[model samples]
Structures are given as C-alpha cells and as structure tokens.
Target: MKIEVNVKKRYFFALLGILLVLGGVFAVYAYNSNPPNPRVFGHTINEVDGITCNSGQAVTRTAAGWSCVNIASSGGSTPVNPVNTLSYFEDFIDRGDTSEVNHPGIISFQGYAGKTFGYIHSKDMFDITFLVKGNGTLYGLSSYESFYVGLVDASVSSRIYFFISGGNWQAGTRNGGSTKVTNLNTGVSIGNSPEWFKLRIKRVDAGTIEFFINDASVGTINSNVPVMPMQIFAATPGEADGRLHVLIDYIDLKITNLAR
Candidate 1:
C-alpha cells in the first residue's frame, strides 16, 4: 500500500509539470505573434498616420489605404530619373496657384501679384517635348513683353529660351554674357484667347540642338559648347499689371540614342 500511494503522488506531480510546460509554450507563441505597431522615424506618427504630400503633388485613396502621386511636375513626391524616358502631364483643372513646386536647387516663388512662373525638372535627359496652351493676357512692360519655355541651368548661360514677344516668336540660347536669338517664325500671335502650341527641343549629336513647332521643324541650334539641361521651366517675364496664365497640357521627355 505504501508503494502504490507514492506512485500516485508522483503521477499527479508529473501531470502538473506537463501542464505548466504547455502553458509556457503557448504564452511565448502568443507574445511573438502579436507584436506592437511600427512607428515612423523619430515622429510620433505610427502606422495609423494618414497620408501627406508636398507642393506640385497629389494624393488619392485606395482600397488598401492612401496613395500619393507626383502629378505634372518632376519636383513632386516622386524622384526624377532621366536615363530612361520620363513624361509628365497636367491639365491645371484643380488647385490653381496652390499647386507649386519646391524642387531642390531652384528658387521658390509661385504666383506673385496674380502672375505665375514655375519650373519642373528631370534627371539629365536632353531630348524633350514641351506642349502647353497660352491663355489670358501675357503681361509685360512696353519693351519687354514675353512668356518663355525652355531649359535652365544653375547659371544663366547653358539655357534655351523659347518665347513669344509682342506677337512675334523667338528662340535663343544663352552662353554667359551673350545670347544668340533666332526668329523662328514671325507674326505668331497669342492673346487672351486660348491657343495651343508645342515646342520640341532635341539634341542631335554633340554639336547641334534641333527645334520644332507643332511637329514642323523650325530651326536648329549648333553649339561648340556642351550644354547640360537641368530643369524644364515656364515663366512670364515682364511688368504688366494684368494677371497672366498658361495651361500646361503635357510634357514628354526621353533620352534618345539618335546622337549616336
């Protein structure tokens, strides 16, 4: 009888130890499976933080959650890479003056006194197609009334200026102090009426830059100096009290192998 009692006691203790071991395993598995939510950087913004975007940018809601897009400007939330083809399109249907750009290494000025001038950029691509509609009075003082679209570098030279002045169209490339101006077509007029125009600028080989308007070859610019296009921009230059505007329909860019 004494032997049987000792055996029963041992069995009970063994069962208890098994239950304790099972319970510990279950606890560890539960803890690991249900970890804490992740946080964003140093901010208090947890995974629950809502969507956010900067100037010249747009955001949309998706079934999974929030999604953001860099609309028309390369300066938006998306980074620019020019080794490949990059294109941007905008209708200006929403967010008027508030839709500005804050591209690095460029001045930040949206609309002042009801006139707008802004820039968009890509990586290092030289071939580009700039298309837009000129609407409303393109303002200016008497001698200097113009609206411009072209490429600009950190300095003034190494820049191409395609503009309309006093109802005449002009194309010019600048190299430091001197600017070579060419009258592509004369009597090209744009006023308050909405008129669509296109400027296609391409670098052919190492010494020549080709210009096109409305798919027609207007002229070519040959330069002995190497010019690297940094940013694609549009500006209304002058001092007219009238408010000016331009409708950006689309801009298509690609790095072409035609030079080779």
Candidate 2:
C-alpha cells in the first residue's frame, strides 16, 4: 500500500506538469493569433488606430506588420507605381519679383536690355513647367533679343533651355561651354502679348531631354543635355526698341531619380 501511494503521488505531479506545458503552448498561440492590446507596467497602452499616407498611398496590414501601400482608384484605374520624388511650386501670389509689382496672381520681371532676371535657383536637375509671356513683340531680332525659360547651369554656359526669339519657338542645349548648340527650331511662332504659354522641359533619361509647348510635344534633344545641376531661370533680354519685361503665371519643378 505504501508503494502504491507513492506512485499515485508521482502520477499526479506528472499530470499537473503536462497540463501546465499545454496551457503555455495554447497561450502563445492565442497571443499570436489575436494579439491583445500591448500593455506596460500592468496598464493597457493605447494603440494607433489609423495612419496617414501620402497622395497616392494607403495604410494596410501584412503578415509581418502594418505598412503603407499604393492603392487603386475607385474608377478601376490601373495602380500607379510608387516613386520617390521631390517637388516645388510657386504661383507668385504671395511672392514678390524684382519689379516689385504687387499684382494679385502674377510676378513681373522688368529689366534692361542686356541684363538677365532669374527667379528660383534649384538644387538640382528637375522636370520644369512654367507659364510665361512677354510684354511686347520684338520679332526679326533673333540675334539680339530673346526670352528664355528653362534650366541653366551656374556659369550660364551649359543648359537645356526653351527660348522665343524673333517670334520663333526653339529648344536648345549647350554642354561644357561648347559654342556648338543642339537646337530644335519648332517653326511655331509665339506672339509676345498678354497671352500666356505653357512651356515644359522634362529630362527623359541621362541622355535625353524632351520639350513641350502648350502641352504639345515640340521636340526632343538626345545629345548635348547638360548633366550638371541646373536652376529654373527665365530671362527677358530686352530688344533694342524698348525695355522688355516678362510676366510669369507659375513655375513648377518635379525631381525624380536624384543623382547619387
């Protein structure tokens, strides 16, 4: 009888230990399956209920954790791939130009015939867009008079620029102070009046540059594209007839795939 009692006591302890191990496994499973609110010092901590995402992104939960994702539109549009981009925009409503013209929605640059007026100095190369128009017509003065809008390097020698000279629209680029210029004369004449023209310059790749006017593709330059960092510049080199001024509606720069 003493032996049997000792054996029974051992069985009881063994059964208790087995139950404890099973309970621990079940607790771990439960925690992983539906994790309870995190606790600290015996107090339940508040968890973030929602997260904010950028323009084309949404918050979602994956197996590992919560993260941001690009979401599709409700209209069944294709999902846009996410890209890292830096952008800058100026409408000139609150900013003043060298002319100090306190207009409601425009910035004016009025200067002498030989001088250049620049607005924004960007840190690097960017896809640029601007709305601009000159004050008067100085056609047939291509050699001496022009209005320039686009990217230019610090020395003003290397650039990818769009210019209207002698009422003709042209896209040109110069590399490393080389006098040889790659020009695309669009043959489309632009009048120097109050009407604004939308001009865009986009760097397609390391070797290509695209130009657009009023949302139409005018030309592309495959060579002579400046590789150096450039600034957004607009200059009105006045004609011999009178002082030239430029009125700008806005300027926007979108930078992607920055150089390392």
Clashing pairs in 1: none
Candidate number achieving the greatest TM-score relative to the actual structure = 2
lDDT of candidate 1 over 147-227, digit per residue (tens): 566776555445665776666566666654355433354344554444456667776656667777777777776643335
Model 2 Cα lDDT, one tens digit per residue, 1-260 = 99999999999999999999999999999877732332211001112123323323433345665454443221122222211211122231112222222211223344321122233323333566766655444433243345676777767787788876556788989887767579899776775443556778877766888899888999899877667656556565543333344544334455542332
Q: Please give the CA lDDT of all the candidate structures.
A: 0.45, 0.53
Mark the 10 consecutive residues where model 2 has the least summed lDDT: 39-48
TM-score of each predicted structure versus truth: 0.46, 0.51
Worst 10 residues of 1 by lDDT: 39-48
**Model 1 segments beyond 4 Å from truth?**
1-125, 137-144, 179-187, 224-226, 238-242, 256-260
Q: Which candidate tops lDDT?
A: 2
